[model samples]
Target: MDTNSKIKRLTILITCIILSTISYGQTSIKNINLKAGKYKVGFKHYTINDCTRTYRIHNDFNNQLIERPIPISIWYPSKIENNSSKQLTVLNYLEILKEEEEWNDLPNYFLLDWFPYLWNTPENKAHLSEKVTAFSNSYFLIGNFPVIVYAPSYQASSIENFALFEYLASNGFVIISSPSRGTETRWLEGGSSKDMETQSRDVEVLLKEINKYENIDVDRIALMGFSFGGLSNVITVMKNKNVSAIVSLDGTERYNYAILEKSPFFNLEKFSVPYIHFAQKEIPEEVLNSDKIPAELNYKFQLYDSLKYSEAYSFRFHDLSHSYFSSFGVLFANRDQRQDKSDDKIMVSYKLMSEHTLQFLNAVLKNEKNAKEYIENSPVKNGFSESLFSKKMKQAVTKEFDYKDFNDLALDQGYQNLIPLYKRTIAIHPNLELQEGMLNTLGLRLSFNPKKLEQGVNVFLLALYIYPKSANLYDSLAEGYFYNNDFENAISNYKKSLVLNPENQNAINRLKQLQE
Candidate 1:
């Protein structure tokens, strides 16, 4: 063979090997199948006067009447005979408004007659809409499952931002989405807090109304919310004990604090239900810091405490903004002429965030024990520990806490026992700063005692405080929270790390597992 030919053949062989390895490593989640399509769902719209008018009533900034419309869309697995086929169109009213405002240079209220029909376009037909159609259509369905109560953002419309909803429904989760009435349009216009109380009550009433539907496992009901909607879920679950679990997508902690203190879920001592918080890394610092405010004076602070009882997980995307978790964020960032740059970094972050959110829902809501491994043992980039002990030692000690102890203690005792050592290490080496050597030492320990998770979490948090910008630290903290059964906190901390480093496959895999 000629020299050039041999060289070309070798290059081709190398490329093939690389591609094969990539494909092998990029395996999707097992036992779960997802396909894009639409399904017919039974839905009902109602207006309720039972709850107070606006949210954040005490805030002088939100002084407005509570009267507004409430619309609810419920989805359940149905026999073909029970319902007709329908095309689904996922709409984002907020995105539409932003687009119209930018394109036409008109007031935000300038209504576009073509807005509703836009989903009918060939390019957008794959999306799911709440509206029904005359013909039966292909709808994605994983397996027959019970019902899930879904809450939309305070101002979002029905079928708005179906990214999360459709993914869940297609993967066997029945969803009921409640839209904020007049609040959708004015929410970003400085009127969101006004009708929150009414919004929460509306969600509860919808749950009661949805009970009339056939084949719904009301006892297995779970609450899933996004952004403002997530805040509503926090409120709804606090008032209604029937909710089994909750999944919040980048939901702020401020609203949770408010409801936990003055609203019905105030007595955290009384509630012990499992919950998951799926937050984005770019969550406003103000919201996370809400807990720092005095609980007596800040209603949101109380809600932060309530989060302690739930399994929390945060998905961080270094290249993503606060709105990235929602479909609107994806669409908005992808648009042309917008200064916001969307690249491979943003796309990967979105995927990672979505996957983690699903993994969490599966573990906490569906009670899938195997799913826990994703959070428990999954490795973040650079050999960062997925447990707390490694994190604490990485932050505090000049040398790594020997894994000999980790494996020995984890097997003999439990993760809880390691907390004191981690705490003491932090106290003793207050001046310790994270370094490559420390990380390597911690990695060695984690390799042996991966289950000594609490100590790993403490170490990770301490490392985070010292190296606040380290994505590895945040990922470790997230893993710490996950093993601790604090899914909400796990999601929150993971998000912080992701925001700093989105390409971390370890974080992405763990996030996907949590979401599933």
Candidate 2:
């Protein structure tokens, strides 16, 4: 080989290596710069066993019916007095990852190379030393703060989205989460419907777990999830009524509506909470074709399209792919050269996503006026370029006011002043009715209770007013007065009942007894 030819080949090889290094460079977590809110963030992690569900430890030879181990990671608003030495570093969160991933004894040094998604690189090594915002076991702020129950991506750690959790906690929101695992083991059955259901149950456990904290506002809770976790959260919202709102970070609910539909609990009518979904950029044609992904996936969102009763917000970030939706993904996942955006663009979009999440939570959970305005405004109005972002929102459909709705109103005021309440409600709903049967049964039930006899009489009066000349309503009214020991009113109602129905046997017997 000639020396000149060898030198030319060497130059070309060096050029290719330099270009490849630039193309595959990793993102530094510091570049994200997620702004913290007014409150100090506190983080705590512990494990509780769900004894109701049996689980098998794959490593155990006996495979006994041990309780399902749920490892909980929580971030919440805290008092400002935190020991600087105990402030959590990124490595602390990775320790939680080890425990939840069943690698409890793995040496901390090998974490980067041990996980397939976490590359062993100098940039990633720097992340381990970077200090996060949360302080370990800091005193909780003394107030009822809204909570968010998070479900992690497929078989992922509860602390997977630590950055967002801290961001939300610093804004006075309590975030609780557990790892996503299979029904019977630490691994899932290939993301099947059964896997979806198992993850949903885990989220419900977190829902009940929040009640233990006195500072948590149980009345106002939201569910947030990433990837497969998103699918589980949607099912959780459908099966449970307590969730006030839900936030999805590039959630699979957009891509796998079929899996959701398979769950018996999935009824669109039950999914009426305020919901927001932040999506990934459209996959490039080359990537789509090479990856064998369906082109319709770029446009089809059956769940969003089919929804009719939720205040839904959908945003597509042109700069983010699905993996970047999570803190762990942003820091650890490898960038696909065919479709991944530049690290700078990805970090900027992540900051925007976090801000949008805060505003949405404030608008729905706290009912903040400014937050509502911010959420309702378009992306361009909020200062983002239209080419980089797009949004679509759906206002919930107005449901009809039915008898059950009226009954709730009646029950709230102890059934007193129903006539006036009905008058006001009917004037507005014109179609609303307090059914004769429901009122009669309600009156009888109340009358039988000695302490509620007067309320029963009030209910009877309302029933008669609505069903004016009905023999049954008058008889029920007579019964209510008789139960209350008001002989004069009881006699007057019995006579009216007899007038309405000459053969009213119950009214006849009651009147004769009263006379005797």
Candidate lDDT values, in order? 0.48, 0.84
- lDDT string, candidate 1, 274-383, tens digits: 55554333323453243232222222223434344454443334445444455544533222222223444445555555565556556656778766556443346423
Q: Which runs of model 2 end up more than 4 angstroms from their true locations?
A: 1-25, 80-85, 481-492, 506-516
Pairs with backbone N, CA or C atoms under 3 Å apart (clashes), candidate 2: none
Candidate 1 CA-lDDT value: 0.48
For each candidate, what TM-score against the reference? 0.48, 0.90
- Flag regions of model 1 displaced more than 4 Å: 1-69, 78-84, 89-144, 182-194, 254-265, 283-308, 332-344, 375-516
